[model samples]
Target: MKRTVDVSFPVGPVHPCWKEPARVKCETRGEYVLRAEVELGYMKKGIERIMKGRPWQEVMFLAERVCGICSVVHNMVFIETMEKISGIAPAERAAYLRVVANELDRIQSHLLANFSYCYTIEHETLGMYLLDLREKVMDLLEKLTGARVNKAYMVPGGVRFDIGEETRHAILGSIPRIREETKRYRGMFSGGPMIGLRSKGVGILSREDAGRCHAVGPTARASGIAVDCRQRHPTYMKLGFSPVVRDEGDNFARVMVRFDEAIQSLSLVQQCLERLPEGPVLAGGICRAGETVHRGEAPRGELSYFVKTDEYGRIAEISIQTPSIMNIEAAAHYMMTGAVSLADVTSIFISADPCIACTER
Candidate 1:
């Protein structure tokens, strides 16, 4: 007996190609998607609940653990919040280093995301090429911060170490190669037919909707929202950075914006390196503290941290909201582009730079 109607697709909380655990249900009429439903495999880990009893200073790493890609941003958020609460700012030199590290972190994130974008678009060679470039940045991070994945370089008052001339020179050496490779790959991106076919006009989120939805980072910029935290936010003000906003609001636009932001981050790092001031890195800021909240730009979008302290730096309560969490709305919205194929959905997922670890922890 044949059924009059149809319903069923094998998708996953686990699938070979998909990195995160999520189930995708699609109503398909042959290869074309008719409808799609995404169910996150697990509830968010609820790490925010863990922050309540930790000391303000220690909570820095806790927040960083929320996502491997955005760990640096989380570290910054916690520190900035602590600074506000305690009424102590890092020395000028420290702030400069924070900017440098933050920029590098953002670069690493975009590199990884773009490579994954290529993977979903069936460009493994380009994906590997970009991944190779990203490795250099990761190596640079390991050298500077001593841990490749989490980095753990951010501490309460400021960054744990400064990038001195010798280290800076080494990092500077890698940039030219990075630029060359990026140029070559971007050439492929523009000329590749597959990338053109899969991404060009897909998942178009209009400019107004992007702003109305309050998207962040490349998403908002791709949609022409112009809400880059760097332009108006206080922490990034002195670092002197501007976002790479695009008006297309398509998959290609989102992908391109990530690449552009990576370049901008590199330029900002150069500026921060040149303008490095002279002073102690910590400024005796953490040992004495109170409580406060800070919201700043992360590679994904706006990151916020709230800290409460008593007489000692020990925290009474700590709460954080990484961009990826709020980023859910944008994903749901863009998904309306249709039953975005597993491939297209995955590509878009990478572009958003989700940090499950960051979001979870």
Candidate 2:
């Protein structure tokens, strides 16, 4: 199994594996990958820098643009950072509403990632089914937030507006369907021979490596790392959140983690609806000058935002640490271990669920 000639290939700035442009320069020996170098910046917009000196109110829209798949969480993290610094307290109902919106976002995001993973494995029918099911979540979001992708519904004090009676009912009613559909898909993905053959025991990442690389979200959880921002975040803490961890640390495990999370997210959304309090969705508060760091569990993983504000209540600086950067880097290392087949590289990369738009930003 030795390489007779050196070979280099690139999976790239325009590849099916990623929604945004990113390049992976891989060196291979025969059928095995010897090393991999991930090249980002193709989608870089210097988002953090762009937020600097912008009005605090305007930053929310800009933050949502960082990544479409997890836009709601991005706005949530940024808004929470602003709220913490400004000492703005959201109403009890507002908090629950935020949770409802976020969990829905998480469900859709996880489904989208798993669907893409299916596509990478050439499971076209399954991928299409997942995408079609995902549209239901999108429809829910559109009804609640007025947009399918960059829902700027969250704000510093609370949500922009209350969830409509019809929207609330729509969301509540949809949970059972979401849960059922997700469970069925999960069964198909886990029990299918093709998925098991291509994923189980392949692209293995050890527990130690996951910790060393600071892997987050499902990627870290699949490796048995018990680091979920939701368990620690104040909001989910109120909701009695729990982390889903699997010890396998393989491509199959990673995909299954998202499936588990999608179901978990549906349950959470149900709770938010059941326990939603009665009060204004937005609170009244004036922006204050200060600095603070906040954390939220995006669909991907631990999303941290550090905000520094000026005396005029404008954003002075903002820093974001997205999960994809860490997880993808860890996956690259795993691929470079020299045991993985060249053909399996994309499958391994997709399992990490890299969002280059989020990473590059």
Candidate 3:
């Protein structure tokens, strides 16, 4: 059998559906997409190069700037790596507070990703609803960290500040509302006929493909790979964390996994607060000379930071592996291949939740 390409379709380096810039070239035969290729490098920031020779204090702030959506995880992973090298551990109370902040960040990020997917699929009403819920989560994040994005909350030994009693109560009180609304919106996304028709089986990435491509986060989890960096993190282990999984490996599955995880995050936040111990939030440790690698569960997937510090606690070398790198590759190749409609190309790409800023960083 022979398949002929009837047309070439190119999406982005700039597109309305995508917030960042990256180009995808699709070879198609009418409505059926035969192949797709991704091109990056439009938004490279050279952040790693900038961090070299800087002290840990400066690099910590730069780490969070890697991705605005999941900044907390970057800050956490970098600081934790430095702490490990320095043989410093945070107080138990501070550890729990870190988990609470990280989980809240996860919830807002998942909601934002799902909202983008909904908007891409032409479900504007559902998209708006998800964004509204995300705003509430952002409010909670602000309440905890004093900033919604790029929160430089985590430090070498612990966190920047302690969570006040009133902030704790406010976060606890808000979880139920966020969780219930997320559940209802997920129902709308899953049960709506038009949405189902557009997404249920669209952009399927098989488990084997997901594994071969090394997909991470919800992208891999949706394909039934039960890998989560949090599962190995000490604090998350203490809180009984588990990755959400689905067998569908479709756009719908990916979005649903995020929804499930968002709900799960709410529970994790509640657990952290209820079990939070009364103690000093800052353990106060210096970043001593060392080298270490650390991984954390960002909203998109696994985020890794490798750091080497000199005797003066200045960064001698640094490298960051963001989840978006593999997820974007998987989207452009495995997920976007085969008989996909032209209408679905952008939606399928967005489903993997590619972060161009993180990828080109």
Candidate 4:
């Protein structure tokens, strides 16, 4: 004779492990999560609703509020939407500037993720060191965009402000120094003896599962998907940038992918600085028209936007698909495939940088 037992466990907004307002409930008899459910829309601010009747130029400002960590990506999506509808294409200089901003944001975003991963496994000294090094990137962002959180440098037709001659030289000056520093920091954070033990075979994502689940960014890259939106559809095609990808599909692999990307972004910035052209930055003044869609690669993954405009230069409709939206589901696949502690699992979920506000909007 056999017997059956079922137990349900609740984890959420108030859980000691959580930093945000959301929950996951899992029912299980042993180590496996038999039934897992996600509770969402805790902080749904309805940003899209506010867009109705706002000017096309104003949408970038509104979209900037979607995600604090990756707001530059958000602004790009919104601006691209307006550009499509208005039939305006920015100058080559403007395009290069967008690439610079987007790539810089990638460096900051990847640093934060890898640093947090350092903290997750009890590598205290490395975590602190990585975080400190990350400050260099953050300070650069503040200087470039005025505010670190919502960098409104990307406007409808092109960049809002040009990189000044002095600032441009200063930025060029920092590249080699920042590159050497990041390379050294990356080595230190690898946590030689202890890290391998913790993450090497842990939380594996099989290549088949990775593709079937439609993973993106470093997550998908680690799992052996070569789909980088930047290369797939070149928003900055003139720069002739190539996508960086890898295969291993584990915690360590994901770390490598991000680390390489940061180095590559630094190199790209140098190229952009050298090739930074001089002309009117913007394409033209605002022109309101019908609806259109645009998509680009966010630091985390793919981001897309659709905006409808009326003759009055106001936002008639809007829709957005953030990488977080797709990656969140991929994360759920990881959680379901193996047994993981709440601690090892948390940051990757946030690492998706799921802007509940953007997805919910």
TM-score of each: 0.90, 0.96, 0.97, 0.90
What tens digits encode model 1's per-residue C-alpha lDDT throughout 1-361?
A: 3333255464666665556766656555655555555566364776777777777656666777788777887787777777777777677778878887888888888888888778766789988988988898888777777888777776666778776778878877777777677677777887888788888877777776666666777877888877766776555687666777888888788888888888778778777777778887777754555666678889888877776777777778767766775455566545433634545665655556565555545
Clashes of each: 6, 0, 0, 0
- Candidate 2 C-alpha lDDT tens digits along 217-314: 99999999988878777778888999999999999999999999889888988888888888888898888899988888888898888889997889
RMSD of 1: 3.3
1-361, model 3: which lDDT tens digit per residue? Answer: 3445678788887799999999998998878898888877898889999999998889989998988998999899898889989999998888999999999999999999999999999899999999999999999999999998988998877888999999999999988988899999989988999999999899999999999989999999999999999999998898888789999999999999999999999999999999999888888767789888888889999888888999889999999999999998889889989845888999999999989999989
> How far in Å is the alpha carbon of 177 misplaced in model 2?
1.5
Which residue runs does candidate 4 get wrong by more than 4 Å? 1-5, 15-18, 232-235, 340-343, 347-357
Candidate 4 lDDT trough over 10 residues, lowest sum? 347-356
**Candidate 2 pairs with clashing backbones:** none
**Global lDDT scores for all candidate models:** 0.72, 0.87, 0.91, 0.72
Model 1 lDDT-worst window of ten: 1-10
lDDT preference between candidates 1 and 3, better one: 3
TM-score of 3: 0.97
Candidate 1: pairs in clash: 55-315, 56-315, 66-357, 66-358, 67-358, 85-291
Q: By lDDT, is 1 or 2 better? A: 2
